[model samples]
Target chain A: MKSMASTSDKILDIAQSLIVAGGYNGFSYADIADAIGIRKASIHHHFPAKAELVAVLVDRYTKQAAAGLQSLREQAASPADQLQLYIDYWRSCIENASQPFCVCAMLASEMQMLPDEVALRVRTHFRNLAAWLTSVLRAGVEQGLFRLDKRPDEQAQMLMASVHGAMLSARALGDPGLFMAIVAPEIARLRDT
Target chain B: MKSMASTSDKILDIAQSLIVAGGYNGFSYADIADAIGIRKASIHHHFPAKAELVAVLVDRYTKQAAAGLQSLREQAASPADQLQLYIDYWRSCIENASQPFCVCAMLASEMQMLPDEVALRVRTHFRNLAAWLTSVLRAGVEQGLFRLDKRPDEQAQMLMASVHGAMLSARALGDPGLFMAIVAPEIARLRDT
Candidate 1:
């Protein structure tokens, strides 16, 4: 049972990286096989179909992200601090060449081609992230820590888009600093006095 | 020669849609052939390889976008109006399902998988866009039509990221209005008194 769990985790990790690098159709079972030195049949035992595998991967990613966001809420005392920490986490990831892009964001780029199962999970991620962002912005407004030109939900959506867009720009430009350069102003504008 | 131009245009049109739907690895020569009802050999005759095909497509897309922005500059009297028209153009695209998404933005999602030729063009598109946006923002600031918390170039990057990010959000959520909802605030903040 222990070995099975590790294998499943390993498979998901590799799938996450592969999906981030090239998107939904970018990698295949054979690619995973070569990377892990496992046979195609093993991957099938775990995932059955490519769509099923990706759907499971997205499901796992969404849960992990939600947990991380929950942890952020618990750890940060202020909504502004929470937002800053969230940006810092992604900044470090991009700077270190580790988990540089959001898997769901990458998957979202291929939304039109994703299986319905996979697509639903991707949508859920955006919705959840937006909700988290909305709550944070609302809290910030209530505490007088941030100023908003739009409603909390609207600000959340804008912030969400900017963060994801910053990721895309950083990757495309091959400049990790570009991420902060783009996103810093987003956080700054919220607290602009 | 005229028919040849139309055939090439048709191929680019289909390739753009396919890339927007998926990513770099999403479609193939056979898919293009099937869509255009032409032999794969003919596609090869026009674009030898997928990398070359996409490189040409990005190049063409960049030129068209540049032309459109130039036209926006000519038609709109001020920086704010130019920015508004730019946003409106994308808003209409998302709403009407005409252009739908930026092809370069979509290809950027698969940057790692993209060949150097195609990747180079994608980078060029972004740089050109950032330059155009920077000039507009600078002009707006000088004209007192816009206020900035960051340098014009940085602000351009932020706006560019927000716009692209909004497109991803809109598509993922299957709500075109989400584009404006996310981007409108980015614009609104600049004009905030």
Candidate 2:
């Protein structure tokens, strides 16, 4: 069971990195097989199909995001600071060239090409995160730490869009600092407004 | 000559749509052939290779963007208004489900997966648009129509990122209104800031 779990985990890790570097249609089990030095049939044994593999990947990514958000809630001092910390988290990821892009966000751009199950999971991840953001911002608004011009739900969408778009631009220019330059001002503007 | 030009033009139209619907890897000469009722050989006759096809598509897309920006410059009143016009342009595209996504921006996300020539063109497209945006914002600042918290170049990156990210979110949620809901406020805040 331990060995089986590690194999599946390794598959997911490689799959995610592939999706981040490319898109859904960009990689195959064969690619994964070559990466981890496993046979293609072995990947088929674990995932059975590409859709299943991507669905599982999206689910795992959502859980990871939830855990990160939970940690942010517990550790951060204020809502604005937490928001900055979130931006900073991506900033470091992108700057360090460790994991410069979001898997779900990257997959979301190719939404129409994704399988129904995988696409639904991607949407669910965004919806869940957007809802989480709305709640956080609402809390900030009630506490006088933030001035949200619209409902937290709408503002959350704006912030989410900004972060995702910043990722695209940063990647487009191959400039890590541009991500922070684009995101920090908007975040700072959120409080001022 | 006219017939050849139209054939390549049709090819560009289909290629851009396919790239927008998926990503760089989503479509092939076969897909383009089926869409246009032509043989893959004819596509190769025009493009020679997938990278060449996409290189032409990106160049055409950049030109279209330039024309749009020029029209906005001629028609719009203030620098802030020009920025809003830019948002309105994307909002309408997403809302009306016509050219809902920017091909260059979409391709930019999958930059690592694209050919060197194609990816270079995508990066060039972004750099050109960012420069255009920086100039507009700088003019706005000089005119006192807008207050920028960062350099115009950085702010332009921010605005460009926000727009691209918003497109991804709008597509992810399958909601067009969210595009405007996400973008209008940010543009509004940009002027106020």
lDDT tens per residue, model 1, B1-193: 4445588899999999988888778899999999989999999999988888888999899999999999999999999999999999999999998878899999888888889999999999999999999999999998899999889999999999999999999999999999999888788888735
Deviation of model 1 at B156, angstroms? 0.3
Error of 2 at B39 (Å): 0.8
Alpha-carbon TM-score of each model against the true structure = 0.96, 0.94
Per-residue lDDT of candidate 1, residues A81-169 (tens digit): 99999999999999998889999999998898899999999999999999999999999999999989788998899999999999999
Best by lDDT: 1
Among all windows of 10 consecutive residues in model 1 chain A, the one with the lowest summed lDDT is: A1-10
Candidate 1 docking classification: high
lDDT of 1 at A33: 85
Q: Which stretches of candidate 2 lie over 4 Å from their true place?
A: A1-5, B1-5
The TM-score leader among the candidates is 1
DockQ of candidate 2 compared with the true complex: 0.87
